[model samples]
Target: MRRELKPLQLADCAPLGTEVTDTDPRMIYHGEMIPVMTPDVAQGIKDARRTLRTNRFRPTGKRMSMIIDGCAGKTTLLLQIGRAYQGLLETERRPDSVWTPVVHINVPPRRESNMDWSLPFADFFGMDHTINIEKRNYRSTDMTEPVVHHMKESGTSLILIDGVDRIHDSELTTAFDYFDCLQDRLRLSIIYCGRGATDIVSEGLHHRRRGERLRTSQQFRSSLPVMEIKPIPFREGAVEEWRSVLKAYDENLVLYHHEPGSLLDFETLLHERTGGYMDTLDQLICQTAQQAIEDGTETITEEGLNDMVVGRQDAEDDWA
Candidate 1:
């Protein structure tokens, strides 16, 4: 298949603004968890997979994946889904344990060392590193063999890999493809976490690095499960839960945070501020509260938020 196709992105479903006239330190605070909101797309993925299996067809277990770009609560949602999946599998009659529980892995961080994933995997599991890090033998391929084997036996059927774009393209692709093959061997389900549209999953099924150690030069790769998790839509349900929490700290959060009453202006403003990402919204509100505390203000108002941002920006510029 030589046809070229574009992957669906959040931008496609919902238009969002990109330009930022200025940045604020408190903006980072908007990236916390808002547990009340539902992960609708993720739930749909799980539901669809379950339905297929219940129908008695040969169901290739679907991997639940979310792309956590800088703004989206990808990792948070992944954890949420994992928790829900755990509850479902814990039932006495269910065979979820036979499938892999959630296995969380990362690609590697940027501006760091050579990003050997085996290190984190080993350290996370309290397993010995293939060799002493100080030793020269650590970089060789032989060391990763044991780490790979342990992962296979680790009973991780549902793999959730974050930091996907952090590693070298070729190396990351190799490691991802290897796990995908394990799915064929052991019926493992694959879930990926990454940035932008790197096309990792499609390429994964095409390359059979383990069986033939071979490459599928075929043009179009198969699609693994993918959902570009955008932020939550601005509404009463979304804001009400978080706003209630924020009200205990700074009352200013409730300024626009009324009973969502189907108001487009409020909805648009909230969504604009939050971009629908629950974590980002939480951070913003939390920062507002922290600023209120620092300013020695008891009740926060709309004026307070503006004053806080202006004061912080000025302070940051002075320090710079």
Candidate 2:
């Protein structure tokens, strides 16, 4: 909030440029200059939204899963998809109405009951989960009816459940059973996200309805197509892929002394440092940019990058 309140004094700070006076210096740190839109991310959003479009009004809405390893920006991709879907929803809905077409909630960790699963939706809608008894005494409210009522009233069509892997093995059956029933009740497409969301969802499908089988193995995996966001490989055929991403970052940088292709020049070094993981790569560049700004260099350099250690890969390399 402090960052938003105090805008960068670009008018007085000549080196920072007048074009970016409205933007804060923290933009470099947050990398908000350019959206997190990689090729795979773009395609994933396209495919997931396509599934939502086709299945949203069906009896039992179809689902999708995203399987991206840690540090590869799975959450970023999910949020981007939500933003895109919300944008689409806005055009189709009443201008004055308050309708949430895309709802995102992190699947609760260590979930133990159906009520526990409903909390995410309640939290999303800002509905209180506790009912007041006498004199400030409170008890948990059954959120099912309110949650469903609000979802229907708001015209929610898509749900994004992030961190499916966090649902404990013991809790999968209970957690997904509620999700399955919710999807059926709302007739909305759900995109489950995590590192191994496919396996987790598959396990849930098998155990859906407390071991009472409703679908076969082929039907289970087929209904929810998985999208992958693996790290960009720095190999002979894919070096340009890494360079292109860096080039996008370079073009969007707000540094005073930044050369057009300065980041692209360090392509190989960055690939080695971040192991092509988007989250790690984002951290490395943002931190390096912050250091450059503090030192008044206003440009990224090999020396600045060398002083910082980011990601588990870099730490392991340091230990070795």
Candidate 3:
């Protein structure tokens, strides 16, 4: 139930110097490593970009979301999409004008009113959302006017909100109302990223603001498209994707002795080691690479991978 990105050739890195110098090229290359464009990240960005592009001028723009369970790289995927979209907007933006086309914020842990929801956006632009009515007393200001003003002024068209899953059922009413108000006024495209996004959005359909009718789940789905990122399954046909992900990382690595596509040799082993979870796989690869660099091995070995344990620690009883 996912779209595949067009295959891309991995960028080639210069070979590290054999001369023993004071600076280690291994460490240097490690710091310069870029985020791997895994299948989820690539496809998510593609779909999100298309949605954002199509919704650019709509009076009521469409919504999109990326949901990933656990630490399967939802934040990474969201940030990449935001950066890619922002890069697209930058080319058309006036060189002298200071405008933010993308706004990224995290859903707050605590939510009481619409003001609470607005706080994160205000904090992002460093706007003050509090008013001092008296010498010692202050009250939260309704930042709708200022927030909308700055958004419109800055030409902000897309908002990337992380952690939508944290919103309590009680807070959904105000939270959605605030979002609805923004859509009605600004027609901005929004991307929600979180573990519980699907359930949250489905549940949100049941909670409607006073005097407002709520849309069916089907209608919401038509408007707000959803994408999910889960652990890659190492089964028939699906195993190839797992290897492709590893291949992407391996090609980007700068290890001197690591043969291109050598990682594919351990495809099944790597999946078994990390259970095909992106975060664990990433940690395993990165930590293993760093260890190899420190140990002067300069290459990843199956034995080295066998020794690493990352991600949610299992219970002592389950330990191998």
lDDT for each of the candidates? 0.45, 0.72, 0.70
List, residue by residue over 82-144, the lDDT tens digit for candidate 1. 556555554633443234345666665532332354555555555665455776666422324
| Angstrom error at residue 276, model 3 | 1.4
After superposition, candidate 2 runs with Cα above 4 Å error: 1-33, 56-71, 94-97, 208-223
Candidate 3 regions off by >4 Å?
1-32, 59-71, 95-97, 130-141, 205-223, 312-319
Error of 3 at 264 (Å): 1.9
Ranking according to TM-score, highest score first? 2, 3, 1
Q: Tell me the lDDT of candidate 1.
A: 0.45
lDDT of 3 by residue, 1-320 (tens): 01223322223433444443324545555543557777777788888878777777555434443343344689888888888887777678653444878888999876787777888888888887677766655777767778898999988777888888788767787787787678667767777778767656555645743234445454543235676687778898677678778888888776767788887888887877777788788788877776676666778898888777776544552665
Model 2 Cα shift for residue 118 (angstroms): 1.1
Q: Look at candidate 1 and give me any clashing residue pairs.
A: 29-283, 30-280, 30-283, 30-284, 31-279, 31-283, 100-157, 231-276, 231-277, 232-276
- List model 2 lDDT by residue over 189-282, tens digit each: 7778887776777778667432344554455542457777888889988787788789878876667788889788789888889888888888
Relative to the unseen true structure, what is the C-alpha lDDT of residue 162 in candidate 2, on a scale of 0 to 100?
A: 87
Count clashing residue pairs per candidate: 10, 0, 0
